[model samples]
Target: MFVRNGTSTLKKVLTCPPTFLDEAAPINEISKKYQDQPLDKAKLLDEYQQLLDAYAEAGVQVEQLTPQESMTNSVFARDFGGCVKEGYILGSFKEPLRYAEHAAYEEKMAELGIPKILEVKKGLFEGGDFAFLRENIIAVGIIERTNMEGFNELKAGLEPLGYQVYPVPADSRYLHLDMCFNLVDDNLAVAYEEGLPTEFKELLNKLEIEIIKVPEEAIFQHGCNLESLGQHRVLSLKQNKDVNNALREHGMEVIELDITETLKAGGGPHCMTFPLHRV
Candidate 1:
């Protein structure tokens, strides 16, 4: 059983290929709610390919799921499920359009010989809000997609496994906690002040974590949502010039990719991946 630590060296990951985006196709509720602008289908495909290539270069195996024509937001696979110390912990998406993805994640976990440890079935909880800070400290955001009920359920499941759950209140504008804070390396993290509450920062202080504050502009641009590939290596959006520079200045090897089209669908590099095994 492999443990699920986001900052660990990633061994294997799963992603969903961007589905066919027929702009002419009638707009669904999901698209209406999330997509702030028109999507460039071709760019989305190119961007995803670049992401896969980055993973390959980092010596990580990338597996992709067949695209679903009906689900426009399927590309953001991180919200579908999460990897824990025991096995996979499946999530129930708050949006109606994403609920169908539960079955897909379940099947993928089974194929990989990873048992389903638990499922957030009764209430909403997306993997995006769940953050594994250490071997025992787990930070969960009570945000739009994740509520108090879901937070309690996750705590109930993880407490037995020796985990301390910290509930962070997420800004309504941001989708998840990761939208504001993410681990850059062991004992280090990057966060956007505007998206974080004072108590949450105090909690990080108590944990003795070194925090790098990303400029407020970068937060809305999805700069804080970058992914760490262990050993101080990071993958961030190309457009996030300020944050990328900040990460590099802090001694991190930064890999940048243009995710303009993908961001339109409400995610960035970290949101695109569902890591299975990290060492």
Candidate 2:
């Protein structure tokens, strides 16, 4: 079945190679600083391959979406759309440059026979802002990328399906909810508390999900963007030493990969993958 929560065991996933990760045209503040120097395509490919290897080692079935030359941020597959227990929820892009990605994801979903449950037609809703906290609960980030209109639309559709949609307000600078908050275990999350609203933190506490606070210095490094592989396992960035160490201390099996090249484009392991099937 499609994933119901982020902390479930990832059995199958979709990804796109960094075929057009050009640093010249910046997408965020992180990429803007790297515009002076061109990205080393060779090194980037190597790093991406290593991520694929890590997934294979974990026994995850990988599917790839072909990237168009002009879609520089297409490598971040998680922004395309998201899956629910019943079907796929088509995403609407806020950035004009990412508008074409929705159509590509639609075609892929159709090809894979994944039924479409709802398509965001009002305002904007990127998949990066959609986070499933539990089987019947989801947190949608009401940030610059995903506005109240979009959140309302999603809530209207999902609430009928027994989902309790929570609106988490975050600064536009964080880009997406996954950037500042993500699940590392069924009962544990790694979050950059300063970047999120106090209510969001309170909500997590109310849910009994312990927090592994990520410092401001580690926020930009995508320290909180690690992926959960279920069974108390996580796929993280080798550079996020503190976060990885904390996971290990909590009895998690952390698989670290060096995706520094991909991080230059303002995404990490979690951002680079779209879950197709989870258990």
**Per-candidate total of colliding backbone pairs:** 0, 0
lDDT of 1 by residue, 6-84 (tens): 6888888889888664342222222344545567778888999999999999999988877777766778889986678
Tens digits of per-residue lDDT for model 2, 109-170: 88888899998897688888888777888998886688899888899998898999999998
Q: TM-score of the candidate numbered 2?
A: 0.97
Best by TM-score: 2
User: Where does candidate 1 stray beyond 4 Å?
Assistant: 21-38
Query: Model 2 — which ten-residue stretch has the worst lDDT?
Result: 22-31
